[model samples]
Target: MAVVPVRLLLLIVGVVAQYVGITPPNVHPPNEQLREQRGLERSLDLVLVTLRILLWSWAFIEGSILFALSGYCPPAFARPFLHLPTNLTSDPTELTPAFLTGIVLTLAGALLRVSCYRALGKHFTFQLSIRPTHALVTDGVYGIIRHPSYTGFMMHTVGYLFCVLDRQGPIVSVCTGLLDGSGTGHTTVTRVWACVWATGLYLIYALMFGRMNKEDEMLQKNIGEEWRAWVKRVPYRLLPGVY
Candidate 1:
């Protein structure tokens, strides 16, 4: 199997898991309450959710097609979208060591993300809506990081990028190219387009951090000193040593 085909299969599974994991109708907040709390009607909420689902789902499907076409067909067709110099157009990419490792990371991330939700059980909602009856979750994965679930999401995004684009990771995301004798600059990401891809993916991790921060504030407000104590003990937000 080609990396792209494996990518296609994995993406299909991911999209399906995301769909099935969507908060059920029974878990949704009441229409009036939802409007009062979220400043959006139930219908509007549904629309927003539908749009999110469409965007995420379509992105993978579209990426798979583009990767496949680029790998197998004439370079000219996919050249405009591809980096100036790319291995995508060369010999078929099989299950290389890095690609296989990426597969493991992708699956691990998905599992970790899902496990967080399962641990939360009835307390978990797709949106930020919290029940008055809800309790602060600090056991299991939460014990590791304040937001291990988001960490898992980051893993999925990173793994996907690794599996398909095979761009440099976080370090490379911030790294810029230095011009070499070759027309192409010497850098982990050889093209501005590659940098854009890196930026977009990293932005999602930032978004997750923002969400986690807001969640911490909400938890602190609701749970008070106990929440403070948990925060002190856990310390880390996403990464253990970093932030």
Candidate 2:
């Protein structure tokens, strides 16, 4: 069997980290409740999930781009579209600093996020909705930061972007190709696709931060003194030292 290239391996790992979700799917908040109170959040999450899936799909295209650049070229049909500038100049098998950094971030984020999910147990949900008999968790990762999961997710997202949108990646290639001839293909298609990616990222950041505040307020309202005490003890929402 042919050994998979390090770049390919990193891409695969990043994709896995990107798609991993909370265990016991029932942990999701009640849609009716979320829609009733934080309708914007509920709507944003729908956009978030769709864009995320599209981002995941890009990994396959990135792999195809890499394979075309390597000695092992893809089939004749794909060769036309795989003409990314990096393909000719860069070695897909070589691991770049950006790629390595991205993989590390993705894995670290995934691990932290997963730990948070486990720590929260049945309390964790994709949306902000306090379940019946909901209790605040102040142990494990939650003790260090009130929103460690968000931090993990942000790290994972930024890292994955670094990895997949590097010079060798397809999106960058197209963006670069727009200015430089030897880059990727298409003009209108590339710009639109790039914009969609950008919008998705923006939504993720904006919505997550908003949701964090909403969560804090909700917790304070519901849990009262215990929530306030936990905040004082933790002192930070997402980061340990930084806000």
Candidate 3:
């Protein structure tokens, strides 16, 4: 318990480090030019979209700190009617299994994203907008899938959620013996918060999926039958067997 705050601080630092480590400072344009380009509506500017995702990410982290550290929640907010567990602390052993797993997954995901960066070189942009001189990248890991970069980002998000859920919710307490747990993930209030949080995450995921489709459409249009042939060979978008 005494070290919990320190651990929490480290967790935040780790999150920032993940961003700093993976994203190349030079890759994204100084000013994205995504207005009404590549099938995207003018309203859906790349800057706006990036800002939206950043806001969501910040909210998720803040929510985790509140719900996990002190069980704080919104004013005038009501708990859910259904029952769930909420009083779980991160395990205190040298390395709790769930915590260890979370760290490993996060690190691995970071590596994957960095690999994607190296593979794409300057071709990678923060937005769906493609450069006129961009070549249809197919060799290397790109041949394995349509979007390794997205897969990397998805993996990082999943790992983050897993760590937060296991350490901060009662559903995972039994595995680590951190609390009484009540055999549930969260109490009504926490569940409600979680649902709201999950909904926000789902929206981001849907947005990313949309970006993937839009990018694919753009590629097929630009690259022609060669792109379609590569798609037939690769087949999967984010996952191997499942979507």
Candidate 4:
């Protein structure tokens, strides 16, 4: 029987521990008080809150399953540094300044996401179809970014890249890094796959935005010229000066 090296054994154990929620030293829960304070306290309000949580949970579970099945992990050295538990045995070179930057970006994105969730208040729902209670929230963070959720999402993606900057980032990262650096003839088929996934994400966002825009139009018709004036004031839709 072929024997697994101690280092590989340890790395596998660490990965398993992470998946089981063993509470890595670098992982910390977001502000609990702030999370609780933002939403409505009523029982009915739980519906929207539950839906929101479930949607994110689904995404995480799906991604994890897909990655595991594909047997792909990215190289952390070429990109970001991840502040993972020191107890985990792996490549020391994974820790770098770039990884730290990724961590900071990720945290900032998480905070923005939480802020957007708070801003949504009772209107937050998981279904692709807009709920009746949904309203065009143009105040708070929404005032600055038309789709604060998307901003939060972008930040979250950056954070994810940072967190996984080790041997577990993404399969595509590993494939590309190997091909680019080692001059190996290995082809990265996942590049196109990643692009497709990205396009899907963008399409989902676009659909959500379209729904919101339609809702906003209805709101404008109902509320009159007030919304139009606000739209004029907030010129940018997603990114500033771009689109």
Candidate 1 clashes: the total is 0
What are the per-residue Cα lDDT tens digits for candidate 4 across 207-234? 4565556556555766567767767877
Best by lDDT: 2
Compute the lDDT for candidate 2.
Answer: 0.70
Model 1 Cα lDDT, one tens digit per residue, 115-213: 887888766654565676778888898887888877776676566555545433211221222223342332444465457657765555454555676
* Model 3 TM-score relative to the real fold: 0.64
For all the candidates, what are their Cα RMSDs to the real structure? 7.4, 4.1, 8.2, 13.1
| TM-score leaderboard ranking | 2, 3, 1, 4
| lDDT at residue 152 of model 3 (Cα atoms) | 75
Clashing pairs in 1: none
Q: Return the top candidate by TM-score.
A: 2
The TM-score values for the models, in the order shown, are 0.61, 0.80, 0.64, 0.47
* Model 3 Cα lDDT, one tens digit per residue, 15-85: 65356434554544534444234433333445345634653575355435334433233433324311223
- The backbone clash count of each candidate, in order, is 0, 0, 3, 2
Instruction: Give Cα-based local distance difference scores for all models.
Output: 0.57, 0.70, 0.58, 0.45
Error of 1 at 12 (Å): 5.2
TM-score, candidate 4, is 0.47
Q: Is candidate 3 or candidate 4 better by TM-score?
A: 3
- Rank list by lDDT: 2, 3, 1, 4
